[model samples]
Target: MLKVIFLAAFAVGTVLADGELIILNNPGSVHFEGSQATNQSFLKEVFTVVLGYTPKLTQPWDGVEIRDPFLLPEALVSIVIEGVESVKSPRGKHFPLNVDEVEEVTWQAVSRRLEERDTNNTLVRIRVGDGLDALGQSALGELKPNSVDPASLKHLSLNNEEDQKFIEELQLLRAIAQKIPSTVTANSKPDVYWFVVSGLRPVMDLHGKDSEATKEALKLLNDAVNDLSNAFTDIYNGQVVVALFTNDANKLRNTRSVESPRVRREEKAGELETFDAAAQNSSDNLNTIEKPITLRLSKRYSANYPVIFNIFLWFGIVFFFSLLAICIAIAGMDPGRDSIIYRMTSNRMKKDN
Candidate 1:
């Protein structure tokens, strides 16, 4: 039984050691409860900070028609015109447009002027149906074009009722990633999973009635993020680290709230230093105020010595049990040769025969 247990444990350890570490980059959508323009601006800033690129704005168009097969589809084309504008088509045709205009222009004409100052090059275009809110839909559409740098952008729908569960799962995957090693070799890089969540806190509080609800919501969000961190830690067996970035400092305040007084004082001092620097540099502007708080969830197992010692201890136990079992089996085999009763019985049986 002891041998079997040891073998099973050893097998499990081996499998975990050999298993490939999984890394995922899961970014949630930019959520905002504000004016359409405010929402768009906020989303642009988010993409700019997280992905390091700002996407150009395109006027909302109903439908587009593409004449050339080789050229980009008209649906994917975007035009930003301020007042009245004139566009020259590929067929040498001139078309005049008024302010806030939507035209079903040919792809050739659009592609020819794609590099122009006013025209915005979209990464991808999505057409929202009649029932959907166009502004909200367009905000989601803008995320992809802006997130072309670090990683591909995936805009998650905040309207899903099951978003809480999805967040929980993300947390679980992150926890798993934390247990695995970040780098397999000196040259090998660790897989990174990025979760970009936005608009968790409300932009305005009418009558200040929703304070408790807002706090609860923030708590839930923090819990989910923490859960993800813990899950990653367990999965990687303290290999992968979790880094959290948020514009709101309150979202991560709970993590420090439970720390010891001495630790909290240290953290507060660090935060004061950061604030002082920001103030001195005048970095707390409208665009930079919503800076992300990066929290690195490193491997909890700081050293390999303890883990190695534990492994050696288990191996010793298994070896000792195996040797004892072998000795016991060998001793049991020659019982009659060494036992007086057995020898007497054998002698009596021989005499009778």
Candidate 2:
């Protein structure tokens, strides 16, 4: 009987490891009560503790920032922009000048880009301690990594009507991580995994108004996060990341007088399905207001001139003056510069030769 049970478990693990990567957001959106800078700092400090070193922001992007050495590389980032199909993965570390808002860069788009690059073109790289030393070189070459079927990702939420079983989210995440390749070898192309569970601490006083239950629930959540973090470190070997995406507000509502019903996990799952369907269907419709004509021009750069100042400013000015002078000189000619030219009657006329 024991042997049969062991085999069943092993079979489950085998199937998961061969499946697609799953990324799911924990139930609800919650943020600490604070400014944007404070939230960012708090997040950084948490990661510093986890990673054993502070991670430097790849770019200090405003509105939305995705910081990680392993996930999205610069070359393939263009696939996140407008006309994703036409944008080939180009060389160099050039960030897209214009990109859709982070929220707009849906998981569908990310999955699509990965599908196109799945032909042994995917590169896995890591940088330790935000330093120049790469944990693995991001060399683009033909490398037969494991094949991953594209899958959709979802952001789950738990409202007042939910059980708020955020801890279970971690358990689900563990199952997903188990699906990843157990080991990375020279010939084995493996991928890293992470979960961004947003909406932990709501600005609204969810448990206020002497509602002892919700308050206790909040306290329980704290214990869960710490316990899970320690477990992930030991079990996953610190390869998978658990990121709690949150923001804080200055003022929180005093809901001591309000009694909001908590939601159960089962109901939340159903809601998540509905939410996922709605988000996918309701993505901002992109209309091409101006028909774009693809124009090919030599990639040009200017030395010692800022792009906002227009590096070609001086060149254009010089060009204009030179052009005008030539045009004026020709027009000022007796007839025309390119007209039938007669020899000057006075090369030696002054000398009367």
RMSD of each: 26.8, 20.9
**Ten-residue stretch with the least lDDT total in model 1:** 256-265
Alpha-carbon runs more than 4 Å astray in model 1:
1-188, 203-210, 248-353
Best by TM-score: 2
Q: After superposition, how far is residue 51 of candidate 1 from its true place, in Å?
A: 19
- Positional deviation of 225 in candidate 1, in angstroms? 0.8
lDDT of 1 at 318: 100
TM-score of each: 0.22, 0.28
Give candidate 2 misplaced runs (Cα > 4 Å).
1-106, 119-211, 235-240, 246-353
The models' CA-based lDDT, in order, is 0.29, 0.28
Model 1, 272-295: lDDT tens digits are 122223223432332232232233
How does candidate 1 fare on TM-score?
0.22
